[model samples]
Target: MVASSLISTNFLFSSPLFPPRSPIRKLTIVSLHKIPTPSSSHVKPHKRSLLPCRPLCPPCLNKLLLTTRNPFSFALDSLLILCTSLALSLSLLVADVDSASAFVVTPQRKLQTDELATVRLFQENTPSVVYITNLAARQDAFTLDVFEVPQGSGSGFVWDKGGNIVTNYHVIRGASDLRVTLADQSTFDAKVVGFDQDKDVAVLHVDAPKDKLRPIPIGVSADLLVGQKVFAIGNPFGLDHTLTTGVISGLRREISSAATGRPIQDVIQTDAAINPGNSGGPLLDSAGSLIGINTAIYSPSGASSGVGFSIPVDTVNGIVDQLVKFGKVTRPILGIKFAPDQSVEQLGVSGVLVLDAPANGPAGKAGLLPTKRDSYGRLILGDIITSVNGKKVTNGSDLYRILDQCHVGDKVIVEVLRGDQKEKIPVVLEPKADES
Candidate 1:
């Protein structure tokens, strides 16, 4: 009877009506009930109890018996265990999600002063920048139809609302036709207005609407200081209106012109990344004012090497004005030819050796003599120009530079060295003859 009662209790513990305790706890309770009773027939039943026990009533015994006979009791226990495990896993996932959401971070944003200024400058000046394309005419071999083919591309800036654009002369040189693309991507056919080959500056005009034109604000390059901030806006590598920032690396630098083979004086040297397609673009000051025109860079691989040169706007302003007025530079001349600098140096001469002076020219009229060969075939040296108006003329370039400062019909005193004697004679300047 006791063994049958223990079996009934085991089944009752596994039923769904009772709480689903662990199998170990259930086994512990069953072992307690099965504690051995003392083998004493004379002892009273209550006094001989091995352990304290709750009396099993008839209703409890009946329920335990019925649970033992049920066949689905084992399946019910397994279902309860699986549901509990699933609930525990879902609760852990929810906790992790909540923790992650509570500690989320967002980045803060701030604007720098220099960066803001650069942005403003680009916005204001980009409209004045333009892209120029050089085109050459090629005729089809079969149809004889001519079409303009792309030769090269570079950058330029609008000079005025009248559609006058300024760029490097080499940018448009040898092109049969030209096109200008504005910042808005609108293109127009450009006609050559004027060009100064010696300065490497060219002016072009397009029939663009006045409202579409934006002229770059002019700045004085003469007062520019080294280390001052500079900006460049150009179509670098055919990429339109690209902005590059740098400081003025040097001043009064000289670069040879690609168009005329003459030295460009007072060039502004910068570290701004000027490349091939940037040739005619404007170099601006920090205040968004046009300071110079990017012309060349010193590089062996035909790329920027951080040594870029710009034609100073101070020189550009005067040249452009003259070009627009006369379609050519009206340079003043002394009407005298000199021996080459190399030849003069070999002769150990310190001054420009006068090779010839036209009989009807200003120098000849002023009684300046030229070198000649005597009847005996011995070379005879004439007057050598030593200075002009007190400025020393060491070579032909110095003489030309001094004459450039004078205008036509201006009277200047010319000092020449004749043998061991120095003479100062006054001569009037004249316009240079057009070789074209």
Candidate 2:
């Protein structure tokens, strides 16, 4: 009799949601020996009975044993039976391990440290978040005001102890009456204190007590980096204060200013889900500091598309400072109309092409040439502004923005391209009037 080693493979498949299982194999060894025979039984020394047998190779033997029947078949069947049982046992063990490791199991029936930290931060800041609803009224045939109409809903935050709340101007655009609700389920009437449409920022005042006002801490946007963790709390589409998490996707991206038609450079881009009502909410850093004001999102379905834009805190800081101090933003301006410097180059010129200048304006009074119509009704070329106060003017917006940094009554040198000649002229900075 010979001993045989039995082996079997029970390979497992893989799934996309779970890790692949390990290949399993079991080996069974059967001990075989000659049975002891009594001496008296072999007294006659009977001629050795030679059973009809053929030398079978290991592979052939296995096949024959597995396929045949009788005493030998029973032994082979036992080997296979043992192998199957071992395989089943191993499978059960592996399954148990997989089930144990597949999902998280809370031991104390509570959140983990990281999760608790997140919940804590949300709990701490939730009270400071607010939901704002804007309503409008329509007149009836009798010229009497009828029922109020719901215009829109948006998010805001407690801005100061003076009951000043801040929100996006677009949120309350054309709104007659505004209402703000805090996280504690308290509502209050709100009024617009100051608004800068160009910056898409508006300050609202509520009659809430000092204890109810908890201004959010402001952070410096200049210190933010791409991929820095961020959080946003807002009333998305009238849904109460909801918190979304993501990272700063980008910075300094030029986006259309909601308040003004001019492009706002240095805007903050985030991946946080900023929906309709999130328009005026704060985009906060992990430290709970406001880095940006959630303004717009790129979504075709009016939902968050994973791409949202915000007004950087630096821009907000500038606008809010002016708004708080003067009730209006007196943005600096250069009294000149011109196109991009690249237009000059594309048009085969070497300077900023002046488009128009207001009569009695700073440029007109400074003797700066302005584009005019010719006798034949053809548009004649005008003075091309090249620089301001020795600073190169790249485009109309650039020149405009640069001039905005200047105070009214500030004197600066203006360079222009008169026809084909470059010359410098002295001009005084003028206050940009409200064009509304």
Candidate 3:
């Protein structure tokens, strides 16, 4: 504010908040009321000329101004006015600075201990994860020419220093060409090494240098406990290297393979997000070890709905080992076609009904009878398999699961219910055919 407005509000030479440093001389004048002059007597008695609340007449104000005017008091008023103005301006400046500080952006803050660990896990594992592209040849309708087009894409991880990558079988099911892209944006042509459709596991080989391959650390899934923390890294929706974390919600879960429609047992179920492009990605434990491979999700809209499943590393480790040694899984089979479980249940049969058995196969040669029809076209039921090596055979899945633990060329005793009498027959298991 200007010096004049401040001085007009309180004309005193000193203020309570901002007092003047120099001492001032006190001035006193005679009260007009005390004067018994001839002019004062002419004034009204109720209105004193010098009363503080009452206004003074022009003649009285002129007489008071002439008496109070002095060189010393005038200089003191000027100094007080200057000092009060500077103090008021400084107070306003300090308030403006404090108000402006609220708008300033804060600096970066330090990350928490757990947050730093998660960040480091992702960085260390990203090099092992890779992006896979499945391309198929298609003929154009108008141009009548054939060209390769991207069929689908998924994720994979390095398996060894030999450039072998592991992924789901359905990812490259009908693709005519495949490409693997590393984290460094380097792309390489990949060829199928081996695949097991029943387990939904496939291995691909890239001719890139061994230095580019960083195998994922393996962990045992057999000893895993529920509610354990896990991390999932994949290319969700084709976006590379997205990390998700959750706890193991379940164990020993079962899911059907998309390629072969067979039951994959001992699967891991987690709440981590796993979308379409996340197939074949690694599901790691808190220790940054591979415990499972994400395969499918339980969602109606085909997007992540928090419930997802992964093929256990114990099952995948065995299957991949067989695939690498042999061109396919080395699972042993009985070499016979049995009736479906639904059909057997309808027939009130508790065991597998042997519908057909080739005469040249092991089951036929071992005296296992196959169901047939007589000359009159009446159904003639054959022997029904009751057990294998002392283990009960309830359905096809149970039989396959038991056989998965057996080896080829191993002799096993097959118990069958022939008519009303039970008979035990010895049969040597054989390698399962790839086409079957």
Backbone collisions counted per model: 0, 4, 0
Question: Per-residue lDDT of 1-436 in model 1, one digit per residue for the tens?
Answer: 3444454455555555455454322211232345445698887666533223346545445445544545575567656655654555566667767877878875655669998899999999999999999999999999999999999999999999989999999999999999999999999999998898888999999999999999999999989999999999899888857888899999988877897566688899999999779999999998999999999999877658659899999989998998777777776677888888898889887889988999878898899999999999999998899999999999877886787678888999999999989999999887766722
Write down the worst ten-residue block by lDDT for model 3.
22-31
lDDT of 2 by residue, 199-262 (tens): 7899888999788778888889998899998888998868877889889889888777765676
Q: List the lowest-lDDT window of 10 residues for candidate 1.
A: 23-32
Candidate 1: list runs displaced more than 4 Å.
1-109, 138-146, 300-302, 364-367, 371-382
In candidate 1, residue 138 scores what lDDT? 95
Q: After superposition, how far is residue 312 of candidate 3 from its true place, in Å?
A: 1.1
What ranges in model 2 sit over 4 Å off? 1-112, 141-144, 300-303, 337-352
Compared with the true structure, all predictions reach lDDT values of 0.84, 0.76, 0.85
